[model samples]
Target: MSVDFEAARLASGTPDELAKATEAAIATARGGIERFKKATGDAAELLDIFDEANAALGNLRELAGMIAKAHPDKAVRDAADEAEQELDKVATDISLDREVYEALAAIDVSGLDAATRHWVAKTLREFRRAGVDRDDATRARVRELQEELVGIGQDFDRNIRSDTRTATLPPSALAGLPDDYVRAHPPGEDGLVRVTTEYPDVIPFLTYATDAGAREQLWRLFQLRGHPDNIEVLDRLIERRHELATLLGYPSWAQYVTENKMIGSADAAGDFIDRIAAVAADRLRADLATLLERKRADDPAATAVDPWDNSFLQDRVKAERFAFDSQAMRPYFEYGRVKAGLMDLTERLFGVSFTRRQDAPVWHPDVEAYDVSRGGELIGRIFLDMHPRADKYNHAAMFTMVNGKAGVRIPECALLCNLPQPGDDPALLQHDEVSTFFHEFGHLVHHIFAGHTRWSGMGGISTEWDFVEAPSQLLEEWTLDAPTLATFAVHYKTGEPIPAQMVEKLRAAEEFGKGIFVRQQMFYAAVSLELYRRDPQTFDVAELKRELQARYAPFPEVPGTWFHLSFGHLDGYSAIYYTYMWSLVIAKDLFTVFKREGLLDEETAARYRDAVLAPGGSAPAAELVRKFLGRDYTFDAYQAWLNS
Candidate 1:
């Protein structure tokens, strides 16, 4: 018998179409839940029914959530917002459904395969975590809390997305920016240049702009995103999260959120932060002294380097001390060529090929879709939405469109980012942007390679939440490799490859900021953990942020800025922003094997894909690492990398 597999379709057309699609998906899920409640026969049969119900619900939620964040039309976004709330209600009902829980709990899993068994156990744990076993009144309140959280989180994110603040400055403020950036932002009829808080604008401006006054102006405005509004919204979010955790018997939301993670508990997460901070302290002090010395070159009375000065000063240090000017490489990293290079690089490494899928549906015109194949067989699909626009998601992330199920469905995902858009002038990217592209694409390929699985729940990037970033972080190492850049990093006009000497300088220059970078990350991680660990009602969020910033970071908090209000992770990652650093520890260790072998060696890449990415969430993250490395991961590699 010949079989066909269909890729997941993105919701398109009018706001009404999006609404109908959402309703239809929810209805299908509800029907699946009904069948699940009636399932019989054996453990496998009941599990199949359960997966079927969740697969529909999961796909629905992913679709609606992506639309809410990425869709172009305000009407469609609003419609998606409503659809998310409705879907959350259905999800809460499923989580609290005692009949479905009992059905799964009664299954005889001894005869099932290990993956299915693990899924069953994990599902039961989630059910309990959702308060499914509680009394009717408690479960009802749990449902209310979960439902309210959906809207609250949406409100928090919406405020940040919609609140794109701008600073109006004269053309002279563009003195230190790349020529391409200057051309793109020519003064308007008012003869004033405008810059926004979007990454494409803010990052380059901060790193290259010579006008300290303009940089400070833009920096403060960037920090003020979602202020006043998100202050109350975030407070409400924290308060309600604590209430939900306490209702479920957790001491605090931090403890509740971290219980299932690799770190084990809130205390462990805190200790890990402190350990990393301690490791970064000496480097932080040295880096601070270096920046201050450079600052004093221009201003003799300078005592401390301001936060707005860090990037520009670092760029100067790279040029002066390391003989590398970041702008010199921008012409070689034009956005279009960078995308092509990344795709070409990954294809060669992983033994897969990508062919454009012109007929595929996408929510935006800017999105480009491709079919991922191996050995001439279609395996999965991916979409790239790689530019900024008003009201779009303002960060880089991989959003799942569909989870792969072996012999049943093919995986699909999209990379939503705010990179420079190609227009009349070529979109030149800084080296850091290139690394970010590689990092997020790491998540995409992981989703594709590990996609094929027996169950949706254990498919794609479904590993422990804390370990999810490891694969992506590991891929970033490839960006700094000279051999890898030779394959695609060519000047846009001349078509000449990036010079090996320049790549060496780029690598050397990157090391200068490692200490300060890690400490700053620690500061964010501290804020993420402490906010939930403490009593939200009693502590002032801004004051707590100031204290944490002082302890972990070298720079003092600016007087009027309230960074916690705009810290988007508080809503999504919540108590686990430390995952980035935690995952990096694992990623750095994983890189040791590749560093020893040739970076372009297909044998090593294939081994990693099979041992690490192919397992998905079927086994514990540590087990997956051991399978690849023949030993457990360690922080020794991370410490060496940090201190090197």
Candidate 2:
């Protein structure tokens, strides 16, 4: 349940020993490269040695985390940090070795089988990109830039995590709320009720309680966090990113970031967004009209939509249209049952079964570790952390700790979610929550199903950035279907099936207020693109936010609340937020194929597993899509769905 200091230490090894081991690996790799270059050793053997050097460098980075968490001595902590930075430099240098690249590039593709050839080609490209084609001085600069980038990223995330405050409301101020909510949280010694951004505290208050004042208080507190303090951090991070790009001879950070992605260039990404935005704006207007009508009917005084009113109004509109409340559907979709259903769906479709692994170390007590297997052959391991916790990353998502490689250890991943925990009604799960579960599990499948035997570099989550969301988005479509829900949505107490009518009603409501949500997401993505695409000296971030927000969802800007400042996704995603829609285009097309055949057809499922899931990043992403779909994907499918 608690973090295991002893286990962390054992896994990390001693700091000094880790540094020594890293140096030894680099030395061995250098010698191996020389032998291979002289044609005295086999290329496969040299590849193994080179991979070990990378692993050693990875171990050094892990050691830094462990030492920061466990080591009491400041000197040791500093040493570990320095060791990590140095090892990063050394690994980058090895990757830039001309002999290594030449050895890889010179590999006779015809001489090797299919699997080995794939890895060799991928590794050669990676080595070339690492500056193997450049001079030593350029390689050195690249290494320095990488180290600095890592440091800046770390600080950026840390500032957000550490710079938030919890609001306190008096017990008297908690009036007009449900008794259970009020009773669950009593006033502290200071005569004030306390709440953190943790899901358990925040979600219940927002959704169930009748106290408008309390809800508004929590909403404002959550929205305003990491704002003013984080603006400086974001600015610094952007500045550092810009400098790094300039050093790499890129005109802007967006250019540098988009190079490795599926879009190939920032200009292409911009074009893609512009096309979607134009299409989306049309649908958004219709959606806004419906929402505003409902808002006016409810309040009679309501004018334009505000950010805070968006969720509440959308929920009301959905209820009115379908006579189906998502909360009412929860009782048949309890957390435990939904989890079992997910595992069953994966096993049936992908031939992967998950068995609990009790021996593995986990980050949290609520986390459950499982060894995923197919026909008794181990595929990978996953640690599911599916409850709300303080200081944990909020929201339902998956994180890859490791990725699958054939003949080696399969990837390890963590499915982190903020779904409701065991409560009075064990089976209760909001429809949206169920969808969230499936979406995240899709990511897990993608992470583990990589039958990537050869190329260790571009496997699983290592694929092109923009294409990453397709698998997950495709899975969400399954969750909303009646037939799919019937397979798992049974009552927790009696185990009775969820009524077909209820599922029908829920499906009918799927696109209700879809425009408002679409616009909200677009606003987030648009602002992110604008942030990186423009010059910071001339751009006023606040003014930019207003312009972008008005362009999507028009509303008065709330002073003192810096939305981007509190955005954690900006740190990792930056100009890439449009990937959501881009990937959805692919996802919708893939789902259409499933619909054409049969949603759960074994032949189609097998085809998906073999062609898309299994190959991971071993094949080009576009090629994988073409193989699975029998046609090149276009944005037409996504447009059709939106219009429907």
Candidate 3:
């Protein structure tokens, strides 16, 4: 049952080949639907239906990658998009079919194990959400809405991905950026640097550019992405989501999103945000005052801190006050060293080892695959695609190419990231970039360890959406630990380990803008909730952002910029953007156990693997957390970290 990704990649290169693959996937789904429809009350038979149904849709993920990432051909990309739509239709049909729902629901779970029983209950919940319990006419409308939403959502993402907004700047504007970065992006006939909205270009320019006007230009262009037009798409998406939630007997889409999450309900999530924002308000004002003072020192006549000025001023403050330069640490985080060190750390801490598979099939040349094993037994396989491509997925994420079922199949997950691509030496990662890498890798580790489940529905990182970021956030703390960085941070040229003092300074600099950062996150969470809670028909997206910034954040938005248009999370995360902050509270609490024994405590790691990661969605997230902590999870850890 192994997927031939090499063949899939090759097949996706041409339209004719992609059509064949799409047809094959559809045929498989059709057969799986037949099996699900004909399933008896036997537990084994029910498992088959679950497994087959999951496998039948695997090709859709493959096609999705091709379309989002590069295929080197526009025709093929268009064809892949078409194939993805076709496959989605088949899967949606099966998902919305009440007969299939009834068949699965009718299976008796009297003597089933916990995982199986959990899957049964989740299936019922999903069916209700899908409107399977609705009347025939209402159910039909729900299916139609589902299909329409899928199409619209795809368009929204495609618009963002296809956007090629860029601003050409003179060489003087690129002064403080790295030499190699400036050289790599040569000017065109007009002799100006080509700065695109790509992370590699925009983020560095924002951090290092000496020209405030240039930085403001980049920020404004990047924020205005998918604007004017994509706003129409966003409007329909919000309205449709609201209508769907209403039909499903929910108050709003936020309620629908949080009902099954660890937060339990939208009201609970809203209340949590209110509490956090209130606690942060005093510090928020203090931070803003400090930033405004720093800004006036730089500009003499500046009245308030521009949002674009935050990073630049912060970098200056770090250099002047803490004597820490983030770009200087990049040489210590050579790509190969980081990867090998992370692998070694995992084996040492998690009692697991990985053997690289140089011959494993991959979607791109930059990707490398590894087979993860524990006690000489194969546990899972992970593919690392750690560099950016021209049309690749913009953010870092882990996608399950294949889900593991208990004693049946091994899990296969892929990490897609936009970490630095090599130029002269190996891709040099900044300190924060190193932390981001660990964060994403933590999710892959969580999925691998958590794959011990009886049902595909209950496998790897399938826990509540709000709790999903907790595992990754916990691992990010390791990047800041001096002992942890000593294991990996070696200079690419001299091979000397990063100085202990430098690590401490990096840690100090991380806390420099904590108030500003936390307040911004609070603003995002509040904005996400409000956008969903209020009526979209009368909602003003820009005005809402202005209100949120004025209320929650230190800096106000510049005039005439639509940041939300390019705010892709509004679609992918919907009303759950608060989870990023919420998950950190849980992660900091989880890390207290690690800090007590040691960062590399194998016994604790084993316990955590069994108690938290291994359970996946087989148990309620709150219960699993309580089990691991030996007491109920609470806010003490988060409060202590904030105080520190």
Best by TM-score: 1
Residues 80-185 of candidate 3 have per-residue lDDT tens digits of: 6677677776766766788888887777887888777877788688877877777878877777777787767767777777775888889889888877677777
- After superposition, which runs of candidate 1 have C-alpha atoms over 4 Å from their true positions? 1-10
lDDT by residue (tens digit), candidate 1, 1-644:
11122323445556787677778878888898898788778667677778877888787688778778888889988998898898889989999999989988888998878877777888899999999999999999999999999999999999999999999999999999988889988999999999989999999999999999999999999989998999889989999999999999998999999999899999999999999999999899999899999999999899999999999999999999999989998998989888998999889889999999788777789999898999998888888999999999999999887888887778888899999998989889999999999999999999998878888889999889999999999999988999899888999999999999999999999899888999999999999999999778889888889889989976889989877888899999999999999999999999999999888889999999999998899888999999999999988999999899
**RMSD for each of the candidates:** 1.5, 4.4, 2.3
Give the lDDT ranking, best first. 1, 3, 2
Please list the C-alpha lDDT of all candidates, in the order they appear. 0.90, 0.69, 0.80
Segments in model 2 whose C-alpha atoms lie over 4 Å from true places: 1-40, 55-87, 96-99, 113-138, 170-192, 200-213, 423-427, 553-556
Name the best candidate (by lDDT): 1
Which TM-score value belongs to model 3?
A: 0.94
User: What 10-residue stretch in candidate 2 is worst by lDDT?
Assistant: 1-10
Record all residue pairs in model 3 with backbone atoms less than 3 Å apart, i.e. clashing. Answer: none
Write down the lDDT that model 1 would get. Answer: 0.90
Per-candidate TM equals 0.98, 0.87, 0.94
